[model samples]
Target: MLKKNTQHEKVSHRKPVVLMSMGAQERKGHDYQVMTVKYIKPLAEHAGCVPLLAPTCCGSEDIEQYLSMVDGVYLTGAGSNIDPALYGQENLTPDKQQDPNRDNFDIPLIHAALKMGLPIFAICRGMQELNVALGGDLHQKLYAEPNMLDHREDGDESVDEQYADAHQVRLVSNSWLSKLLEAEEIPVNSLHGQSIKTLGAGVQVLAHAEDGAIEAIHLPEVEQFTLGVQWHPEWKAAQNPNSIKIFAAFGDACRLQVQARS
Candidate 1:
């Protein structure tokens, strides 16, 4: 533990802890970007869960120790890509920044959380990570891949403008998301170039981009919540009713799990 989160300490006894992932900030001398306040705070505020930053350079015992303290896990989008070798593929480009550290940490954390039946909410790189961790594979670069939409946007646009509803995501009929949102389709902010290529075992494809990119996934066998989306909902969660609903459901599931343990 780098430092106890003072905010969480105030009311963590009442709120369920959601262990959130952060990108490995390797620049400016190495250190863990365990969790971003922008990403983690929303889970605490809107979702009604206590956010805890899970470090990326810990051993299995350290991970298991922390996993015992939290009620759920939240995996965030990262600037770096997952090392392709984990999923039996080679990187198509040498220019990509890869995170073996995060891969080593998160994959085990995800599996341990899954085994514990903890609620999980994932986004973007986290979503892809969920796939690879569960014996699935990914397309290195969708731009070079045939018959897929160029999911990347103009790099020069401000983050706000870039994430402003680029496309619509159609919900799968009779899926968990369809029942939750009760909407046929919803617009989402797209900001990634890579996408899931193969469906993972025990994973359900819950939504898709108009061009057929896998937009969302759900694991049905989990005792509690398990959902992952390719687009970012945390960017403007308060404004998006669907994002609010999703987080709320996850938070509720986490609470229920906590009550069951007690």
Candidate 2:
């Protein structure tokens, strides 16, 4: 039985720590943590959850400590590709853009979260990481995969906006994702080159792209909210009601977990 807390009465008092990958970017000969912080934080707040930022790389502090401290985990998106070695696959092409620090942080954190049955919400690269962490594999390059649409499309080279409704994902009936969104199909912004190849142990496919790419994954056995989507829900959630429900459902699940533990 999980111990419950009584002091934190308000939902805002329940801080859900979000584990996000840090991107290393060099500017004026200085390394900096450049990431999409503007997008996720507000949406999390809107969902009635306090977003606690968890660093990708840390010392000695095991994930269990972080998991025990927070109500839920949000795996944010990133640009780096998962190392092929982790999945026992040969590198078709070396992705020099990979961040080893984030990889080390995410792998252990993922393992700990799964073992402890913590609620997790993953997006884009985070979704891929969750799948890989659960003994799944990735396509490595989506373009290389025959008949797949071009997923990573920004509006323009100079523009900062991603392509809106560039693709559509069909949700499986009677799936947790479908039940959460209360819909059959959802339009989403795609910005990923890698995708789930083989699902991990105990993971279920919730949605799929028109070309048969895995768009969403969920694990029902754990009785925890662990869901991953290939598209960027944070970007859509700001304006789309269904997207808002997605995050809200995740937040609610975390809240329930906290209440149960308490």
Candidate 3:
């Protein structure tokens, strides 16, 4: 038997764990919490992190605990729209889908995550949640707003077609996204009806669509990585260089958090 050379082998570093907020859904008669594989794949493959789905159907009391268990937070897009009342507006789109349990849980979770300085990557509806959580408002019906382009995905299109590049978003000069993508502008997919109407207290615009809708944002004041995009970067992320950059940056930030805790 050979003796183990433990002295020469370095201890392996653990991958960062990301707490991902999930959507509330109903299948048949029972209500359930769900998270799509699309969101999980990039976090695991590109970000090199363990994906932990946090159920928003549950109460928000565990947000602090959830924060303690992970190095980063991921807020994924959902099929439902946020309740307009959150930003002090009446429910103008009452006919649109809404998930009250998810709304109640995720808002407090975003607050808690920010308070802890945890890196957050919010997408689509997740971006809206982050905005509302920070005192910003959204255009309940973006297309309805004069001069704004329709950003919603075509309902009858296949998944791949819907996630295909819809338009170009001009990156803010010298912003983090522009630096990462190494370009002034890039093509992006669009699949949302609401968009930022007012900038959040500390949220800085990172990119914009041709029609002037906010395409990307980040907290310039935050030390940790904080980003939100109106597009679904997680869709076919491995195949997109821009999406790869976004996930890679987020992964690096998460790993740094792991090192800090160690």
Listed in order, each prediction's TM-score against the native is 0.92, 0.88, 0.95
Q: 2 or 3, which is superior by lDDT? A: 3
On residues 1-262, what C-alpha lDDT tens digit does candidate 1 reach at each position? 4255664544444678888765667657867565666687679767899888866765445788888999999999987899988899988856977777789888998899999889899999999999999999998888777777788878999978998999999999877798899887999999897899997888889999998999999898777789999998888788889989988888998888667665
Candidate number that wins on lDDT, 1 or 2: 1
lDDT string, candidate 2, 1-262, tens digits? 1223344455445555555445556689986765676556644655667665565545425666767777777787776777888898987768446766676778778778777777888888888888888898988878688898777765464223574677789999977778778889988777887889999888889999999999998888787788888887787467777778888888787778677765
Q: In candidate 2, what residue range of length 10 has the lowest lDDT sum?
A: 1-10
The reply for model 1, stretches above 4 Å from the true place, is 1-13
Candidate 2 overall lDDT versus native: 0.75
lDDT string, candidate 3, 1-262, tens digits: 1334452232126789999988778889998889999999999999999998888766888889989999999999999999989998998788988998889998999888888989999999999899999999999999999999999999999989999999999999988689899999999998999999998799889999999999899988878899999999999999999899999999999988887886
| lDDT by candidate, in order shown | 0.85, 0.75, 0.90
Q: Which candidate do you rate higher for TM-score, 1 or 2?
A: 1
Give the winner by TM-score.
3
Kindly indicate the candidate among 1 and 3 with the higher TM-score.
3
Error of 1 at 176 (Å): 2.0
Model 1 lDDT-worst window of ten: 1-10
Error of 1 at 256 (Å): 0.6
